[model samples]
Target: MTLNDLSPILLDAAAPMINPRDVDKRLPDMIAGGLDAVLATAGAIEDFRTTMEDVAKWLEIERSGARKIKIARSVADIREAKASGKIAIVLHFQGSDAIEDELDFINVFHACGLRVMQLTYNARNRVGDGCFEITDGGLSKFGRKVIRRMEALSMAVDLAHAGPRTALEATEVASRPMIISHANARALMETPRNVSDDLIRAVAASGGVVGVCAAPFFLTKDGPATLDMLIDHAVYIADLVGPQHVGLGFDFAEENEEDYVYFGYDERYIPMPPWTFPSRIASHAEAGNLESSLRTRGFGEAEIRGVLGENFLRVFEEIWGC
Candidate 1:
């Protein structure tokens, strides 16, 4: 099977948890639902170690089946896994908080197969401020250094939750193409977390791909966003940035109500502020449109192939050179 023939690789650039035991139970259902892969955040190096062990166990189960789960550290790995009818689980970090104040840990993360790392989540960090901050401070001294280190390590720098100034600054400084892995177009949604048109164009100009998110708040305020609305957003981005520069990073967290409450109460885990909590859960129900959008939006095998994994794979190959 080719990437096009395989199921959709739902790349959630930010997920609260990566429990191997939980994923083991979830993967079978996800596979049955035509889910080929899931790219999620480990938060930091510590999280990566824990998540990696769990992923290894999950893949072990797949080893016994006709289908398998493979960790993709490069474009070749993703393609090869697709051809073999396997899911390519690409490890990503959603925020720099897990890294703490140290920048050297980036190298440690790269050594451990971390393919993507974002600068911030929804608040201020050592690297820079998030979109919610009142003052949009651009990349700090340390942030620039971090970008340089990420380029050297060949990790894809993400600006998903970064503020406008920081996102632009990083785009200008990073040697390799970066991604706003999970976000929407601000022009459409009018959310601070969404990227502006100029930033979208800049990312495209830099040969980077923008993964439009399915979060409710990112879509629109009128009502629950259906698959058509999601596709409409994708089409809008494609029109502005070109098709090759757009993809889906659903940002879907498959947690139940209990999980939702647990995360909402946990100050550290919940990236958004208190005001944003209601919208988070309200937005959850509309995420199913993600797959439907791909199928109904006139996105053929090639477009779906690129949106599902190839676009991200190409960028990874350029940065990681693996």
Candidate 2:
């Protein structure tokens, strides 16, 4: 890989989904790991009230001392955060359960700095069915209206945890491309959470990019995954579609905590859930080397740059605007 591939503007499409209180504690690792910007999930499987409260904490972080991170409402703010040596944080919601029945809150949250929202988490919701849902019903009528509003407001649509049928159907309705913020190729690992080749192709055809997941047990079936394996998934999507449609969306939740309140704690009962914490892959502290590892494997600088951060940056520039 050439030196340019290692450019310092590493944008993590999806950092670990953590609580608002953890923002102050997680900022240092993001910088240390070579990340200049990240789409940090504010909350999932929650209501608008809780999601707003989470955003409130992020706002507090921006106002706090040292000011290590900044809120990124646009592509310009994201670049500014990187140039200033701070991690640009764009708030995200993993599931639309937070939207509840308030359709107008989509606009309200956009005004509050919320940029990304998925229709569902891991089960059926008002928006649609998740990957883990028994039925594969796609977007509901309300879900369609939600997408329209999201487009009008310019929020990135995420379908990472969405069921195959649901994700594909959502793509059919999205005027702009919808992103699978973090997921692996189902062709590689036969898990519900991992997306199918058809879904990946459709999303890319719609001008959206797929952020290859970095969490372990999802990348490989034989053993715990390494960066090498993670790249394999990213490259698979690039080869299937194009490098422009692939990016890094490592949902690296390395054993921070587990809430079995929903998915339960047994892997045998639900193999798809991340009940197995501490992904064999690297954590946020070592995220800086994600690209370095790619270089060592002899990837071209252009491809490395695209996978490292530029691809998602391009998508963000298009959807969120410069």
Candidate 3:
């Protein structure tokens, strides 16, 4: 099916969605609105895992509905979800810390349907530091080994939060084409976490895909980010690395305003950089314009299909060989 057909599915999956902060909120209405599937990040799962019973309860509700949510591991799974009108989920970990430096646990997480894993988050971990670090020491020996293990296991590696040196080094060392799951262009936003043009070209050349994040901070600095600017970043990256190599990783969450506190600064671990949070950073709802932008920019069913999920689906197929 095409994205036009898939749009309602995505919207349905996004309905009520999964709110990691509050379990009291009932998403049955949202599910009734039409949600096909959800691809939740590690942060979401970590925050909610504390309430295992709550998680089970929510999943049970979804399964009981016409909109069944299934974890996606391969292209076939994504296609099947489209055919069956179910929501396909691909569990992605934003950092390795969820596993807490234990390599053996990777397989355990994988067994639980954790398909995509990034090496680090915003700060340093046993694997390596993020782009925000003053001194990017590149990947640790253990980091390289971890990446190799991920490749061997067919887990898609993500460089979204890694430092420039770390991301480049990891890409060079990885035997497979991995993903920069969610990021913007440094050329556009100039954030440390944004991928550089060279890195973009390298990733595309290696047959990987880059998901342009819908976060305002990464898209522009002078003012609030809109869907137009978000598409501008996509167009820019497509110019540098071809349209097929780019996708949308809208990094949006369903949490309420109160839950934004969890993202507050503590500074206990690392110092915050000046541009850590860009000016005019709006609420997560600001991302709602994404679909409109994609459509307005003349992205038809095929490109929209890819950017929506097909691109990542293709990369997963390439690395997972499924």
Candidate 4:
């Protein structure tokens, strides 16, 4: 059995349509599509208390017993889940806003089983400017310290929605392999949220991987994206930085037309409601189609495997060292 994967936010109060605990409803699609693990966001620009609650919710899901979902705090945990026919959930933060001004909060969250965190969201936080910021000042003095502290604690730093300068600058500060969890190559799609070739190379130079997102707008300009468009992104990054530095992170969210604001998405960066992901592989159940599309696009077995999930797992092992 080949490994295929897509990452999604497990739970969001704003998007109540998604409930991972419903094994009969959603878990089958994920399992049938071979989604081995997900990077469940504990918080995105929320404060400490709310973030901790998010963590608690995930913990509750793990204990729910309604679904075979296990929280993977390490690579070993991931393997264990895979062997036992359970879905592994990697606790993640889409942004570091939960930490507020304190760097010690990173340690606390790590202790609470947060293995990955993005430095910023669509807008700036105390750490640095996000992609939406007018002036890309890069990381703050405190942001640099946060990076050092995270590295020491073995938590993978993500640059998904960070500003261009901030993402590049972060690579310079981060000694370990970092990730741009769910972004497309900006060279292909000229979105502010997309990662640049320079940033992609910088991330790869540090032995990191960039996961190609399946968001329709991020893939193409005007139309709903297709699986071909998604593979085009994978091919672009693979050709640029090699297949080992590429992976899949389909940042899927089930939101009502009105909850975008509640989710902290600005109108400037996000498209209007009823946001559609790429066709053919729209949801986790259809994600298996990606492998065939990649093969048809002239991707080899190993390259396709790396783009599937092994690439991200490799970087996780490097940072987590287990």
Best by TM-score: 4
Cα lDDT tens digits for candidate 4, 35-109: 777786668878999889878777777777666878888877887777677877788888898999998999999
- Deviation from native of the Cα of residue 54 in model 4, angstroms: 1.6
Q: Which regions of candidate 3 fall more than 4 Å away from where they truly are?
A: 1-37, 43-67, 253-292, 298-301
For model 3, where is the 10-residue window of minimal lDDT? Answer: 8-17
| Runs off by more than 4 Å, candidate 4 | 1-25, 64-66, 264-269
Using TM-score, rank the candidates from best to worst.
Answer: 4, 2, 1, 3
- lDDT (Cα, tens digit) per residue for candidate 3, span 1-98: 55435453332111123443342242343244333444555342243244233334445544565335556676667667767766566666777766
TM-score of each: 0.80, 0.90, 0.77, 0.91
* lDDT digits (tens) for residues 23-119 of candidate 1: 5555555555454456655554234356456545545654665436677677767766767776666777777766666777777767766778889
> Compared to the true structure, candidate 2 yields what TM-score?
0.90
Judging by lDDT against the true structure, name the best candidate. 4
lDDT of 3: 0.64
- Model 3, position 45: C-alpha lDDT score: 22
| TM-score, structure 3 vs. true | 0.77
Clashing pairs in 3: 12-34, 12-35, 13-35, 13-36, 36-87, 37-87
Q: Rank the candidates by lDDT, best first.
A: 4, 2, 1, 3
Model 1 misses residue 132 by how many Å? 1.2
